[model samples]
Target: MLSIRAVICTLTCLLFSGLALAQATPRAPGLTFLYSLNCTLGASLPVGAGPNGNRVVIPITGGSFKGPRLSGKVLPLGADWGLIDSKNTFSADTRYQLQTDDNAHIFISTSGPAQSDGFIHLRIKFETGSSKYYWLNNVIAVGILTSGNGYVAIDAWQLTSPTKA
Candidate 1:
């Protein structure tokens, strides 16, 4: 009877251990909507097939962005030097400048791969000298790109921890 009780206790402990492990699993980071950028594009300047892939430079004419935190206009002086690999996988590499409605300048850089959903997923980084927008310099941002005739639209989001600091 003592041996049976011991076995039962061991099984209970194992089951509880599994439950504890499940409960302790880390949670995924949350996303906070950052901004939406809609920028007009000029003609695609094909660079032909390079050593890496087919390169193309698409000119950014101008655009606007808005969000809960900030609103801005994309300066008309940027380009997307995107590439298409042999497997036809598109990778986006872009650099742009933004001027906030309040007149602060922010430089933006983004790079990522095109997804199966016909949208490019971007890892965005920002640089700015304005103290008001300095937080953008440390932001972990992402964006989804959807391009249409003469333009591209990106909906950006920032990753946030579940707990407030």
Candidate 2:
């Protein structure tokens, strides 16, 4: 009887331990809408294929944006250094500068997967010294890129969770 009681106690402890370990972690917070910037792209200059992928460079021509908290024009000094793989998936590394209507200067970089369905989803980051827009420096942003007529539009969103100070 003593041995049976000990075995039952051990089994109960193990069951409770398993239940505690099985609980899921907390989910990340949702995204908040930030701003959208439309950029025009020049013709693609294909650099041919290699082991990594087929490389191409697309020039950033010029464009403008307007949003709730920020508005700006995309400067012309940037380009998308893109790659195309054997699976036909497209990815882009794009860097550009922006000048706000208030004369604040910002540098932006973005990269992510692009689908042939005419849309590119991007993870975006920004660099700026303007005190008015400094919150952008710390948040993780996501963007959607689509094109029509003569330009591409990027809709940007910010994750709502605050980062550690």
Candidate 3:
């Protein structure tokens, strides 16, 4: 009877330990589907070499975007201040304005690195005073940028906690 009780106690402890380990495991957060924007970039004007790299200015001519929550036109008058280091990595800092179809104004800025593969990954942020779209002012956004001919396209996604969905 003593031996049998010892075996039963060991099995119970092992089972509980397995359960505890399972419960302590970490979970990864899920990405929610957010909005996307496409932008057009104008010609890149070389600004000579700086201490860090070669400086350049790329104009943000104009573009339009249609997303689930918002659709608008990208206004002109914005430019991308970029630098290309010796490693050939292009870092771009772009600031622009957006005008929604309803006349709401939004300011946007994105900065990121572009490799030789021609893909630019960016961290984007927004500022707006419109009550209808104020949620954009406080969210984290990621974007993938691509260029073709005389245009640049950016697809943006907003990150959200899985629990919040």
Candidate 4:
């Protein structure tokens, strides 16, 4: 009976251990951790919602139009990217990339004592895939105190990973 109880306990611990490990490290399959950024950033987007609506939106803020214009630095604490701007640009350069079929899962975490050099922006492009049921998962968090108080900025582009079957 004692041996039986010991075996049961060992099996239970092993099963639960796997679950805990999975929770700690979730991954989105088929995509590689492309690249990331910190501190300051930049870009430009063209838009056309209407004559009075969003005609053109571009990320032309970070630095020089032809140079590395973004400034600032942040530690990986928490808080994802905020929707500073959006345009009809056909580029996924501003965000992370995951290349799963249509049902790929994505997880993002943003933690930080945030800060900005009074600069932030985003642009949207065509979500292209062969699958018609493509889904998008977006999560943005802002842990920034840009006015009186101070905060650190962790540009999200720094943390990217991939998962494969």
Top model by TM-score, which number?
A: 1
lDDT of 2 at 128: 95
Q: What is the C-alpha RMSD of each candidate to the true structure, in Å?
A: 4.3, 3.9, 5.6, 14.9
TM-score of every prediction relative to native: 0.84, 0.83, 0.79, 0.19
lDDT (Cα atoms) of all candidates against the true structure: 0.95, 0.88, 0.85, 0.32
The candidate with the higher TM-score, 1 or 3, is 1
Summarize candidate 3's per-residue lDDT along 1-165 as a digit string, tens digits: 469889999999999999998784455555554556666777789998999899999998888987888888999879999898899789988989999989999899999999668899989999999999999999888888888887887888888765531
TM-score of 1: 0.84
Model 4: weakest 10-residue lDDT segment is 60-69
Clashes of 2: 0
lDDT of 3 at 84: 88
> Per-residue lDDT tens digits of candidate 1, residues 1-165?
569889999999999999998885476799999999999999999999999999999999999999998998999998999999999999999999999999999999999999898999999999999999999999999999998999999999999988744
Candidate number of the best lDDT = 1
Q: Which stretch of 10 consecutive residues in model 3 shows the poorest summed lDDT?
A: 24-33
Rank candidates by TM-score, best first. Answer: 1, 2, 3, 4
Number of the candidate with higher lDDT, 2 or 3: 2
**Which ranges in model 3 have alpha carbons more than 4 Å from their true place?**
1-25
Model 3 / residue 49 / CA error / Å: 1.4
- Residue ranges of candidate 4 with Cα displaced over 4 Å: 1-36, 39-43, 49-52, 55-95, 98-117, 121-140, 143-165
